[model samples]
Target chain A: SQQGEEDPQALSIQEGENATMNCSYKTSINNLQWYRQNSGRGLVHLILIRSNEREKHSGRLRVTLDTSKKSSSLLITASRAADTASYFCATGAQGSGNTPLVFGKGTRLSVIA
Target chain B: DAGVTQSPTHLIKTRGQQVTLRCSPKSGHDTVSWYQQALGQGPQFIFQYYEEEERQRGNFPDRFSGHQFPNYSSELNVNALLLGDSALYLCASSIRGIAKNIQYFGAGTRLSVL
Candidate 1:
């Protein structure tokens, strides 16, 4: 079964605007990572936030994690049309050394010019 | 360094037929993982291979099996394929013992079972 569930199955926004997507998980996670898939192709690793960490940033991407709530959010600033893709959130179980990731149904983001 | 790579970008097979999908891990990576993504759904973990051993597996049945070579490359084989087996197969590579365990993925092979 999928551990994480993403909210706002789909979202649309104008270029230059910010887009936010949230994900909730059922189990305790050692870490939470976000990935982006383009046109159903390969997924690109975006950012990762460890359980001990509350927030992280990579270029235009910012990620926040709340262990108490078992949820995470990805914020993309200054969105561009090129940013259009499906964003997914995956969780690594605590103490599961190098285990497979449990992914949530992705959020399809569309940036219109 | 080259990223993870998979062959036969697209494939078509009939029910009850067996199929094999191949994947080459990224350089310096010692682990390879496979995932099955149905349309409009997230990728489902199939299994993970490390040290040429099946270290972990998902809830898939025996029909889904895999082998990892000494070179760290891997293959996913499904026997007696059913129409429900159609999906995009993804291959991911990562280094073992890494704290983050971040995975690098390859463009998946789209399989269609008729």
Candidate 2:
């Protein structure tokens, strides 16, 4: 079963505009991670936020996690056409020593120039 | 360092036939995990191997089996393939001691069961 569900199944925005994607999960998690996949290929790890962390930033990406609400959000600043891809959120279960991640259906993002 | 790698980038098999997929983990990684992803869907966990043993598994059936070698390479074998089994099979590798267990992925093998 999938543990996380990404909102706005798809999103389209102009290049240079910021894009926001949200995700909600059902069970407690040790960490929440975001990954990007291009054209059905291998996934690239984007960012990871632990349960103890509320937010984190990397380059143009910003991630926020709300453990109490069981939700997380990813924001990409100054989006570029290169950022066009499917974004997924995955959760590592609490107390399950390095267990397989439970993934969401994902949100497809399109950046148009 | 070379990242995770999977072989037979694409495969076609008839129903009821058996198929095997291979994966080589990234340097220094000790754990390998497999996932199956259908069109327009997220990747579903198949199983994980560590120390050359099956450490964890998902809700897949017995037809889905795997083996890990001492060198941290792995193989995913499926028997009596069904049409619905057609999908992209992904291999991920990570170090067990890493706190976040960040997984490195490969391009994946696309299996087409006819």
Candidate 3:
């Protein structure tokens, strides 16, 4: 079963614009993380926000977590053509000691130059 | 330093056949986890290993099994292969302490069950 479901399935934006992707999960989580995957490539970790954190930032990425609503959002500011990729949200289920992360289908973003 | 590594970037198999995929974790990492990603879907956790022991599992059936070596490398084996098993299999490695769940993934093995 998928723990996270990304909203807007896909997004297209111009370079220099900001792209936002949302993810909603069903269970309590110890942390929520965002990752980026270029076509046919392995996923690269973007940023992680712990349950106690409301938001986090890394380079051009901003991640916000709303544990009460079981949702999170990832914003990529100054989107670039190089940022064209699929973004995924993964959750480490609360109390699930040492379990692998449960991921979402992801949002496919296309940045037009 | 080398990150996680997976072998045989691709594989083809038939129904009722068995296949094995391999992974070598990043240096100093001790845990290995496997995930299955179908086209247009997220990677689903198959199982995790630590200290050569199966520490946790997802909803996958018994046909999906794994082995972890003393060197912290691992293998994912699937028996009675079905078309539905055709997907990208990923291997992720992480440390055991404060970074327990922050995994580094290897380029997945693309499996095709014919």
Candidate 4:
């Protein structure tokens, strides 16, 4: 079963604007991570926030985790056409060690210049 | 100096045949994990290898299996391939300490099952 699901199936925004995507998971997680994948490319890790952390920031990306609600959100500031890609949220379930990851059906973001 | 690398870049296989994909993790990473991503879908975990042992697995069946070498390189072997198995197979590697799960991924091997 998919552990998490993204709210918006797709989003479109202009360059310089901001985009937000949300994800919700079912089980207890040790941490939540966000990744971006360009069309026909490998996924690039964005940022990870541990269960004990409520928020984290890396470059232009901000990730917030709400452990109590089993949800998380990713914010990309100053969007660029270069940022156009599929964004995925992943949760590492506490017990499933060595398991690759339970990824959500991502939110496709389109940044138009 | 190198990141995780997965090979062949692309492959074509026939249904009922078998195929093997390989990966070499980033330096200092001891665990290798594999994920399958269908077009327009998020990646699904297949399994993970640590210390040359299968440590955890996803909901996938036995037809999907893997192995990790002492050098931390890995291979994913799919037997009796099905068209449904056609997807991008991804490999990720991570260290084994407290930062056990921050995986760095390879570009992924695109597998086409005819």
Interface RMSD of each: 1.0, 1.2, 1.9, 2.2
TM-score (second chain) of model 3: 0.97
Give a tens-digit lDDT track for model 1, residues A1-113: 88879989999999999999999999988999999999999999999899999999999999999999999999999999999999999999998558789999999999999
Model 3 chain A — which ten-residue stretch has the worst lDDT? A91-100
Query: How many clashes show up in model 1?
Result: 0
- Evaluation by lDDT, superior candidate among 1 and 3: 1
Model 3: CAPRI class: medium
Q: Write the per-residue lDDT of candidate 1 for residues B27-81, one digit (tens) a residue.
A: 9999999999999999999999999999999999999999999999999999999
Q: For residues A18-83, what per-residue lDDT tens digits would candidate 2 score against the true structure? A: 999999999989999999999999999999999999999999999999999999999999999999
Error of 3 at A46 (Å): 0.7
In angstroms, the error of model 1 at A64 is: 0.4
Q: How high is each candidate's TM-score?
A: 0.99, 0.98, 0.97, 0.96
Which pairs clash inside model 1? none
Q: What value does the lDDT take at residue A8 in candidate 4?
A: 95
Candidate 1's TM-score reads: 0.99
Write down the TM-score for model 3.
0.97
DockQ of each: 0.79, 0.73, 0.65, 0.60
Share of native C-alpha contacts between chains A and B (below 8 angstroms) recovered by candidate 1: 0.69
**Collision count for each candidate, in order:** 0, 0, 0, 0
